[model samples]
Target: MEQTNQIERKLKLMHVVAIGLAYMSPMAVFDTFGIASDISSGHVPAAYIVVFVAILFTALSYGKLVRQFPSAGSVYTYTRNVINPYLGVIVGWVTFIAYIALPMINALLADIYLSAGFPEVPGWLWVVGLIAIITFLNIFGVKIAASVNMLLVIFQALVGVIFAYLTIRSIVKGPESFIPIGDIFPSGGEVPELFGAAALLALSFIGFDAITTLSEDTINPKKTIPKAILLVAGIGGVFFFTVTYFMQSLFPDVSIFKDIEGASPEIAVIIGGNLFLSFFLSGALFSVFASGLAAQLSASRLLYAMGRDGVLPKRFFGYLHPKFNSPVANILLIGVLSTSAIFLSLEAATSLINVGAFTAFSFVNLCVIISFFKHKGPRSFGFTVSSLLFPLIGLAFVVYLWISLDIFSIIAGLIWALLGTIYLAFTTNFFKKEPPQIAFDELEA
Candidate 1:
């Protein structure tokens, strides 16, 4: 295989950020706000604030790794290069689960929302249709995927702006005062409860790291990917904080929501009538589609990276389309897996995905610590703090969230890890040596 046969370099800073935001899906605040509000006792924004800071720390570490390695493997590449290849393989599998599960989650969400609007159509049909569309877009090329994501992200942001505007109007005209700033703090819940809520809220920020998986396909990845990572997280955090602040003001009581998942849509009706509700649903659908598309895109690249390294089968997973310069096989594989969403409940799907995401977060933080120690030299205190101290804090936060995950998620995650370990032992000839190594000198050139 040659470098020209691999993914083409076409993404810029804007395209990378657009894909990251699409993966984060600004409309996701609407999907999870009611649950977070209930958990935090009307302090949903407060929980988001906590998660935003925690994710920022981890995002900084991601910036360092992407700049150093500049490969599509993400945490897998970072861990393999800095820590150990076996651990990297494990991280790759865990990351695979996380990335693959996200698109399924989005597909399931789309199915749920579309099913409500069109009862005559089957939910499975919607899920399958979305999976097919996202797969096609991704297989076409990274540029097409980025372009589609840009349009979807713009529409979602516009919807959020309208939502914030209406929320402010309701606050000003209604009996309530506009300065309900107290609602954004954790007044009703204790620290443990607040932490739990923040952990759940952190799930909404998982997609920002998806940008790093495009290192191989990004121009000036060392510079562009890092800035895009921070921008995505920062912009997303502001969007989440502002939207949830207004939502908390409009619907202060969590008890009022008849359906937690549907709460935002219901609020849209109350504030802007049926017309706004229709627009809101449309925005939600587009956001979910964009998220799924980005998820599949990143997941396929991860698989392609592993395949190129001989960790996975090369003939299929590693193959790049000659014309499109995309991982067509891996894209179709994700599409096939996404159809399983129709058989799963949203709760079950999210729980499994959260497990993989938190596991990857914890290890990425650990990878930073390892990298810092491995490449020690005379450097400023600023370098030490950015690479070591911040990652340590992020490690603690993600470990806490990992321990706090539901029992089912913990059990399933452990099982997945166990399976990976068994496969590694067999592949490495009973732990006698490394599994395999792929020379990246040519790819890097």
Candidate 2:
């Protein structure tokens, strides 16, 4: 067997955090608030609060796993090392679906925003252009992608803060009719319904786990990756909370939005006029573009990890540029696949993306529990809280969210899992042998 080529460690904590933030896309709170508000009956911020707690627990579990086995595969490597390799293969495929779908969704949203601004330009053109730029940067190296993501993330954060300030200013300065604090919680709803709404809001937290995929490329993966995961989740949660609070404040009535998905841009127009509207739209477009870049970068790394492990064709998916130290073929593959978003509506594309993410989230929680039992022996109180209790709580939240997924998403997710099972069966020869493994000693050293 050819020796495994290691990815150079060039990413620091901030770089990983930037990549995570870029993947989360702070401006996403604008794009998703309408659906969340509609579901929660105007309590978008409340839903985010619930989902934030859930994500925090899962992020903790992720941190634990990364400390034990720092690798590029994220959930795939964790599950394979802690559980079974066959199951790991399935997790890898599911994660691939999530990562790939995310970039496509971002690309599609970016194109939609751009087309709204310039109706003369076709949406496909924006999609192609965005994918091409991201592909080029990722193939160059992780640091280049990280630098671009940092700049974009900073710009997006500034836009979000400015929008929130303007929204609050509008409320205080405008007519007394504005209800600033009323819409943060649901007016009237069952607990289960709030949980369901929170489930949808949880999708906004998808990118934090993308940090783990950069483990091989990060400095001190054991420490930096974990800290980045928590920081990303926390920072993103605060962004969601602050922005959604102001968003609901500005547009108190969800019924007014003719198109809930585009409500953020319209809110920008209402609060800050055409200039800020232009700023908001441009910021959103750039934010989603940066997100697509981060998503593609993480997805390629995941593919490279799987390829190196012999779970996939090593010659193609596994090979990195001798100098660039990047999974060039996988980056190109994701770039090509991302353009398919031009054919898909935003709703249809986004629904499919979360299925894999939710699946991986649940499994990662389980992997943490299993690892705790295997390594820690009998659980003490501290172990139970850290390993067993927290993960179980996290799993419960994930299961609730999974059950609440749209019917089409559920059907599609099941079909994807079934396909993965078939592929696994054939690859493993009916589970008679262990899947191929790549030792990490040299890379770790």
Candidate 3:
């Protein structure tokens, strides 16, 4: 069956709004603050400020790319245009893997969050349920997907902003316990170490790119693409920086950090948690649910594009569901892989997430610089400084984070990327692979 291409321009714009905000919603606050605590001691808030600045530079790079080439498949899409198609497929495949890992980790995290209330229910139970809900929304259609995501993002942002406002109010009210702003630069611990720790948490800054993958469904493709990304990062950077500080101020206790008793770093509960933290924890599943929903949408589009381009089997994945106008087969394929990966690495999902993100970020940061250089096509001077210089620094920081990943986490990234290379070779040969699909048809013609 032929794909309808019915995703109207408006829905595409709305998709951008939904995906951009959803990625940075309430769950992200948990993510940022949680990671910050692990690396910065009680000064978790200060760590966010560092990551905020780093990703903010990278966001500028993304903004330039989206303005020039607005299409699905994001990083791979951009890289394919300037470099070899085969190379594009490798980047695309690796990113697809990273995208898949996102949902698995999020769903697993949701399970843990839900465990606080229904101690009897296994976390994977929540994982399964989340998979079903988001998959269905994805299958239903983009209009419904966008609407649901928009509502979810709005709800998440509202609740989070409220939490932020309250945390800020709490800070102003009295001498609540917290790592003061002055404490951001360590008194004795290595500055490089503190920066390294903060870099690891830069994983939270990743959602800014989530907007890029949905380019196939965005409105005013060139205009909205750049604006949405910058907007999300701007909001996310400020939001993360502000909330981490306030959470520390609201409850200055290191009391929450003891005996997490597992692989996952229990960041939030350690920093500013009590019974009230349960409220956020309870609501957290929805945030994770939101992340899975957004990631699935992005990944499936990627999978579909791969099939359409002959890098993957077209017979199975090339066809779209008649009713859903979506790639039901590819969506299910990614969902299953993601679910299996969660259990396969249940012991290591969290660490691997940070590690995989670093790998992808390093690849992307480097890709941007490479793409910037390879572009003989017309590009503004301002674009050069923004995309090139910024990504170089971002790439350096990503490498710094890559080394800091625990031995096990580094092993996981190496193995995953290695496996992806193998899959790319076999699949490319099997499908009689050709060039990467340009996000813009005009670029090729």
The candidate scoring highest on lDDT is: 1
Q: What is the lDDT of residue 99 in candidate 2?
A: 89
Clashes of each: 0, 0, 6
lDDT string for model 1 (1-445, tens) is 4545467799999999999999998898997888888877777878888999999999998998888888899988888888899999988887788888888899888888888989999888999999999998998999999999999999999999999999999988997654356545665436667777898888888777888899989998889999999999999999999999888877778788799856887889988999999999999999999999999999999999988887787788788988889988999999999889988888888887887788778878999998778775875799889888999999989888877778988788888889988987887787787856756665562
The TM-score, computed over Cα atoms with residue i paired to residue i, of candidate 2 is 0.95
Candidate 1: C-alpha lDDT: 0.87
- The model with the greater TM-score, 1 or 2, is 1
Best by TM-score: 1
The better-scoring model by lDDT among 1 and 2 is 1
The residue pairs in collision within model 1 are none
As a whole number from 0 to 100, the lDDT of residue 349 in candidate 1 is 86
| 162-276: candidate 3 lDDT, tens digit per residue | 6776566666666665555576566675566568657656777667787777666666677777777777777776766676677766644545645322211243333335654
> What is the C-alpha local distance difference test score of each model?
0.87, 0.86, 0.67
Question: Backbone clash tally for model 3?
Answer: 6
Task: Give the range of the ten consecutive residues with the poorest summed lDDT in model 1.
Answer: 180-189
